[model samples]
Target: MSLEIRSLEIRIAASTDADAACTVLRRSITECCDLDHKNDPAILDAWLGNKTPQMVANWFNSPTNFSLVAVSEGVVVGVALLTGAGKLALCYLLPEARGQGVGKALLARMEEQACSWGVKALQLHSTATGQEFFARRGYVDAGKVRSPYGVETVFFWKQLDAGAEAPDGGKRKRFCNCNPV
Candidate 1:
């Protein structure tokens, strides 16, 4: 079997890329999910409502949330976000970008950030379309949850900086020897 794999560049997202970020996330939630979810407004809102450009900009407020975009042929085709408290906010790849390692690379970037920030653990609420992908990356389902928008989601988690250092989300609460990201 063969597939055309395009060259991709993954970079930390700037505010300038917010629009493209929204597009990638919208496509991932709307175009990649199952028929039922695709048709359900509640699901759409739950999965992507808070991912718009303005919403993403607001997320940038805390300085803990970071966004990254994966570009292919100068087009934004994938995006991932990590929020404060080491939460994996959103991760999505365009249909054409799937299975081409874009998602994996994007996720690795977030994981690397978490490890560097002294984040003790990372978590995310995954949809059916994304559960397997997260599982493949050492994330295990902690449980299922319902989002504010009324959509059921699967929760996954990973631990980082286990030994002696972890950030308690404050300047002086450092418990372990933190690694620079």
Candidate 2:
């Protein structure tokens, strides 16, 4: 099933929006990413601990961070944050928002912002669930990273300023919208 995303809005997230964004983020991590965490109590606790509403709010208000939210009908369905240092720090979407192009919209906004900030490259740690999403956006895998919580993440990087060719200077095929009609 896909969401009828009429007029989805992507914008910078404000501190006051933290509560709702935190709910979406936490739910995406705990429920939407169950395939990776497997409902392990320790892993869930470790992952969820860092996403407290207050902490997320602080991140929203941080000077060195830029956060964005995707809203449809006034509800924030997805969230992403990028650090000033060019790290695509986080991206998460509610289960209902997946496969509706919300992630791609959020990613494009973040990448544009990064380019405007003079970022030459961008990097992110993607979960098993998000590996393909990042790949489709031209991110190349660097390798795997294991978190202290025992969850393994894939490292991905993309060159923001590379022009007329892929960062690796190889011919690249653009993503095709292959969803069946």
Return the top candidate by TM-score: 2
Candidate 1 Cα outliers beyond 4 Å, as residue runs: 1-4, 35-38, 45-48, 60-62, 162-181
What lDDT tens digits, residue by residue, belong to model 2 across residues 8-47? 9999999888999999989899878887799999999998
Clashes within 3 Å, all models in order: 3, 0
lDDT for each residue of candidate 1 in 1-181, tens digit (9 for 90 to 100): 2334568898988887778878877877777876328577766676676778887656544477787889987888888889867889878888777898988989888877877776777899988778899998777788989767665789998655545342475343332345634
Candidate 2 segments exceeding 4 Å error: 1-3, 163-181
Q: What TM-scores do the predictions have?
A: 0.80, 0.89
Q: Model 1: which residue pairs collide? A: 164-176, 165-176, 166-176
Query: What TM-score would candidate 2 get against the native?
Result: 0.89
